[model samples]
Target chain A: MGKLVYLYGIIPEGHDINELWDPEKSAIEGEDLPYVEDFGGLAAVVTKVSEDEFGETAMEENSNNTAWIQEKAFHHHEALLELQRHTTVLPMKFGTIFESVESLKQMIEEKEEHLQHTLQTLEGKEEWNVKAYINPKTFYERVAEANENVKAKREEIEQMSKGRQYLETKKLDKFIEEEMFKDQEKKAEEMYDRLAGYSEDSERKKNWKKDVTGREDEMALNSAFLVVSEDLESFLDQIREMEKEKEEDGWLIEATGPWPAYHFATMEE
Target chain B: MPIEQSTRSDSIVDVLELVLDKGVVIAGDIRVNIADVELLTIKIRLIVASVDKAKEIGMDWWESDPFLNSQAARKEVEDENRELKERLEKLENSMASDRTQIGEDNK
Candidate 1:
């Protein structure tokens, strides 16, 4: 049960980070609070974790414990976010722990060059997430309403006998679905490009499925944008306007964050 | 066709996806490959990656992804249920007619 260093993230050196702790602020499960470790030009935000807790076997076990991982991951996100507010941060993956400070420092020393570049690139920029959703039932219904073929088919079906009408109705549904697929592709691409315009760098994040989002609507696009802090409003403004324009078509746009550039927190240019 | 059981809440999915799946990787002395944490992907569930990756993972649901234009997933379920109902009706109606023919033959 020796102590290990769990790295939250890295930031530039020399900022007085004392404000980060509220001597009264509670720690996660009575664990030691995070502290800044000076690595010369760069600093690492870390906390003391127990070897028996954050060790590989523990991580493997905890990762499966839904309640355990959720709380820990949220705390990890919050920690990086706190640092991000004061200075640019290069967030580390969850459960990054070292047996000793020496090994952690060595790893930082190796990646310091890229880390610095990433910080520079991230300065004053916030990572914002934009998730777009479309309700298929609504989309289909609306598409059917405006679609000329659907209207023509409805009239033709009205003229058919009961048995014929059943088959015709099915054919109409199949046709609507085909048209909706094409529309989904086109609409998804257009929305992505439109939102990407507001950010300096954008990553196409995978849209989580129903099982994760806990919603019935399909997520067409889940994207992250590295938006300049100043232009955040414009990014959100676009989202609002887009939703307003398409709400009836069952389009839903969700904007979340000021997140700690997790997607762009890489050494790669 | 399937919604695997999940105890994960909605709020934590994005955070875990980013920090667990996307953040910078620095090899630590006592490393954890999150993949070993089976719950990693399951917790995040069906992150509709590119169509190619979706296929690679055998997540072919998107092909007929009953949901279109991102209505979340509800609309698709509703639409699918409706379609299924309609098809069932058509089948039942045809069966009824077949029953009538049997009645005549029985007579």
Candidate 2:
């Protein structure tokens, strides 16, 4: 049996190991290596990997197999969510694997105090994911209708000599790009101000990576909040109202959660 | 389900930000394999976010793209749908014919 490690989550102190842990499963069996299983209110599981078996070749065979990754990722999240329901856990992001259980134990022990504080602060507070998308049609239409300067520039270019017109159009393109960025920023600012009152902590996460949509330069204003469970309702109500209000502004405010604070929780090394 | 709306404060939360920007990053020898083909370890950054927002952004960008109006692509989608419908109808007819043949053979 080769070792396969699954990181569960970061937890606080005083978790009952006997109650929380299950005997090592055969599915994750490795050499009878000395297992180090200690959690700071957090428990991570690990099994050895037969380097020869899982070497680059095996993983390559499994890549592009969406169903395979999805299956494993879903189970991984399910396990983390299951732990989260009963304990204050900072769920690790999907696809986190380790070399061995002893390594996991050592890592946890080293970060025990930081993990504990994170758990305590996050206790009763769930992470909510919010994303805003600009409706391009509405945004463009609004820009065309409202910005006289833009219209004047376009008209001037249209009336110019052909050579000058080309130059003017180039200038106009630059102006449009700048205007687009300005609009994105303005919309982002407005949205942040609206939602900040509801969350104890909020941040703008920049998504520099390409996404499934294949759109380059998509603006993602990612943020997290520490909301008391009691206020969850009012928080939702406000978002619904804002959604209606910004329907024409090309703004999409989406929320997902009560999830573990995967973004906010950091291990103190 | 009642959608939990966010409150207005100076703080704005972007799902993309948290999932893409923030998180524990442990860099290792990264490798992505696909069908026995080892593509260079494409940096795999895990971004966890709300599915709805992602879809909205996708739809917005798609509709806004000038290329979406290309006749060839639009026709391709139409042809695909027509083919799918034809296949589905063919399957249904085949099943019906089999049932009728079986009934006649029974008699």
Candidate 3:
């Protein structure tokens, strides 16, 4: 059976990989060769996988296979979660398989300094993703009820003929959409600013659409926050506070994780 | 290694977001040169779109949100309910064997 090296992460030397994760719990069944390879001071957490499935051409062909992608994605995260429990993992993006151990180590040596610095920066902090969704039901009702323009249009529309009322109602929806966008921006920025205070670093991410979020409400804010373990309580407390405060204003704030710092571990020069 | 016992929730989208979209990009020998993050994201988006279409045909994807429209949402709930009932039946069977322990604990 041909084998390939699949890297899950890199970390500074000290850990015994054997004690870090259980082979019985390995993502892929009937695999026994997950190990740590020391390169200078840093160690690469890796495993031997079947070259047939993970080789360059095979991965490309399988990339669009939903069942395959789902399996890989789930297993990759599961392995990392175990690794993350034991150390500050400079996580390799999924599918970082190598033709051989030699090339993987060569890349590690070439980027050792940058990788080390990234590890230092990520040492104590974990990432939490925050998303704010606009609740259409209450938010639109409140905004429409409060706006002078909407109030005026309501009275004006009451006096209009049926044909004109239909047009005005369509116009009213367009007006509310504009109002919602402007309000969403202001509220999201304010909330992001407040959330940023409790974290080491923060970044704004692209908001997911309703189709992606699978929620009826629209996503207005997508952000990642790196919070130290000590600051996590306060960070979450702030989210809880915002979740309650923002609801009346049509926002639902959710904070998820204590994840390995996916955002902060980037080694881009 | 700071691997805690904490269980972080992630949908398939979140897994794709973290695993595919972000991380250290040491180029691999495999075709998955996720070095181009934007391209991979577009590819993932296409996959997600197909997943949505699958849901339309009554195919269920694991980690799907329960917030789909009424018909789909009801279907998701029904699926979950069936699974829960099966689990409840198994638990009831196990309880028959563990009745003495339960009686002792209840006291």
Residue B70 in model 3: shift from native, Å?
A: 26
* Per-model TM-score (chain A alone): 0.87, 0.72, 0.87
Ordered by TM-score, highest first, the candidates read 3, 1, 2
lDDT (10s digit) by residue, model 1, range B9-91: 12345667777764323446776755422234333332332335444645444344311222333333343444445434443
Give the best candidate by DockQ: 1
Q: Give the per-residue lDDT of model 1 (tens digit) for A2-22.
A: 888888888889766576544
Q: Which candidate is the best by TM-score?
A: 3
DockQ, model 1, C-alpha based: 0.18
- Considering every candidate listed, which one attains the maximal lDDT? 3
What is the Cα-based lDDT of residue B61 in candidate 1? 42
DockQ of each: 0.18, 0.08, 0.17
User: What are the lDDT scores of the predictions, listed in order?
Assistant: 0.68, 0.49, 0.69
Error of 1 at A129 (Å): 0.7
Model 3 lDDT per residue over A105-220, tens place: 88888888999988888888888888888987788877787866677878999899999999999899878777767777888998899989888899998887543465778888
